[model samples]
Target: MKYSILVMASPTAGQGSATAVSFARSLLARGHTLHNVFFQGDAVGNGLANAIFPQDERNLVGEWAALAEQHKIELILCISSALRRGVLDKVEAHRYERAASTLHPAFTIGGLGQLVDASANSDRLITFGH
Candidate 1:
């Protein structure tokens, strides 16, 4: 099966992010394909490059990055939500005259069109939220 996940919760506040990651891993282990992982609302913060976590806490950003890298998953952040939350790509940063872009290499800052594409292309679109 092909699955796409839409995550709408902040990584630090709830189980949404962790749940999505675990589900993705399980699906892959079961021989499924991940179409995409789309981050919206506070979830876009998951792709921020400057999040700092205590040593005791799991590194959500690093885990997500590893998933994308290892599984060749497409990680997309909602551009409007990300911009409002100060998540910027190099192009967005240049266009808005920002100091620098905070988007990580593991993810891409994109618009709703990507989500639409994912929904159309994937067999299932699952949402993880509060």
Candidate 2:
């Protein structure tokens, strides 16, 4: 089966984003294909590369990056949401005249069209938050 995931939860606040990652792992373990992971709203925080988690806490952003790298999964963040939340890629940061970008290299900034494309191509469009 083919699946695409949409996560709208904050990366640091609650379980929604973590649950999405775990669910993605389970899907892959079951021989499912992950088409992409779209981080909308607060979920875009999951792509922030500079997030410093405490030693005792799970590094969710790192986990997402590793998963994407290992599985060749596309991790897409909503461009608008990400920018509004200060999560910029190198190009975006330069365009906005910022000093640097904070987006993880594993993720890409995209629009809603990518989400639509994923939904159209995949068998399931699973959403993790409201």
lDDT of 2 by residue, 19-114 (tens): 999999999999999999999999999999889999998889988998999999999999999999999999999999999999999999999999
lDDT of 1 at 83: 92
What TM-score does candidate 1 get on C-alpha atoms?
A: 0.97
Tens digit of per-residue lDDT, candidate 1, span 50-117: 99889998888989999999989999999999999999999999999999989888999988999999
- Candidate 2's displacement at residue 102, Å, is 0.8
Please report how far candidate 1 places residue 122 from its true position, in Å. 1.2
Point to the candidate with the largest lDDT: 2
In model 2, what is the error at residue 84, expressed in angstroms?
Answer: 0.4
Per-model TM against the reference: 0.97, 0.97
RMSD of each: 0.7, 0.9
Give model 2's TM-score versus the native structure.
0.97
lDDT of each: 0.93, 0.94
